[model samples]
Target: MIPSRSDWTKALEIRHGKSLNEKFSKSTVAICGLGGLGSNIAISLARAGIGKLILIDFDIVDITNLHRQQYKANQVGEQKTTALSNNLREIAPYISLEIKNTKIDEDNLEELLLGADIVCEAVDVAETKAMIANEVLTHMPDKYLVAASGMAGIGSPNEIITRKITKKLYISGDGVSDVKNSIGLVSPRVMICAAHQALTVLRIIAEEFDL
Candidate 1:
């Protein structure tokens, strides 16, 4: 069963503090890409008590995604955001969720980012990821960006470094790896990157880590 607000408050108090939990429960985050990184990050944020989430993804799940993504194999062929939304609701029923089963582009980028306290770029495509970064940094300079890159293939876990791009932008994962090389991805590395992204989101929300 989903935990109640008071239960969440108590848990946070035990884990962090009441002040941190309050900040987390009041923040809104938008996650672009419902694949491996985005899926794990979104679930982590929801379980941590983020009050609202806006999830966007254009593709449907495939058997290949089951290796790293949090969705079940039965969800194959279903829209990415839709399946993730169902999963999150099961985890945090009291939280508000918005799912956009469409591609994030110049046209709808603003709408997708509207009212989002922080935007996480977990998409796979380089072009779309760069576009979102430029759009967000240009229009909403104060908003935070937690992005993942070079998460493909098995590499040194120490290679994944979380760095600040700007006062409002942060990136995690190795800088050299690429999906084009067919480096491939396994669950461990993807989840590591996702954890970094989620922790960055939490830090941003709590004002503990400034850009």
Candidate 2:
């Protein structure tokens, strides 16, 4: 059986302190893409008791995604948005979740990300990443954007670090590695970058600015 909301947050409150837990429980986060990076980031935030999540992705799980993504082998044919939502609900039943199984473009991106306090860019394509960063920085100035740059290949995990770009934009990763030129994405390095993004979001919610 699922635990009560108060019971569920009681442990998180102990770990995060009541004040921080309250902040986490009141914030809404939006994650774009549900691939390796996005999936790991979503799992981390859900476990942290993020109040609401807007999951946007248009892909379906494939057998290949099992290696680095958060999906199970049995969910290969399922839509990513639905699959991730199911997983998040199992982990944090009381948290609010919003999912969109459609591609986010210049037209609909703003509306999809409307209620989010923070936006996470985890898309694989470089152009898409740039578009998301530009859109959020230009139009949604009030929202914090945590994006990844270079987490591909089997590089040293320590290379993945968060950088504050502007007052509202933060980037995480080595800022050099690209999958097109590298050997490929390794599970650990991708997860390290995802963790950095997740931690940056948490830090923003906690009002812990690194600057």
**Which predicted model would earn the best TM-score?**
2
lDDT of 2 at 93: 93
Weakest 10 consecutive residues of candidate 2 by summed lDDT = 151-160
TM-score, per-candidate, Cα-based: 0.94, 0.98
Q: Please list the C-alpha lDDT of all candidates, in the order they appear.
A: 0.88, 0.93
Name the candidate that leads on lDDT: 2
* Cα shift from native, residue 186, model 1 (Å): 1.4
Candidate 1 stretches with Cα past 4 Å from truth are none
The candidate 1 region of ten consecutive residues with least summed lDDT is 1-10
The residue-by-residue lDDT of candidate 2 on 99-129, one tens digit each, is 8999989999999998999999999988899
Mind giving the per-residue lDDT tens digits that candidate 1 earns over 143-190?
889998888788888888799878888999997788778568879999
lDDT score, candidate 2, position 160: 81
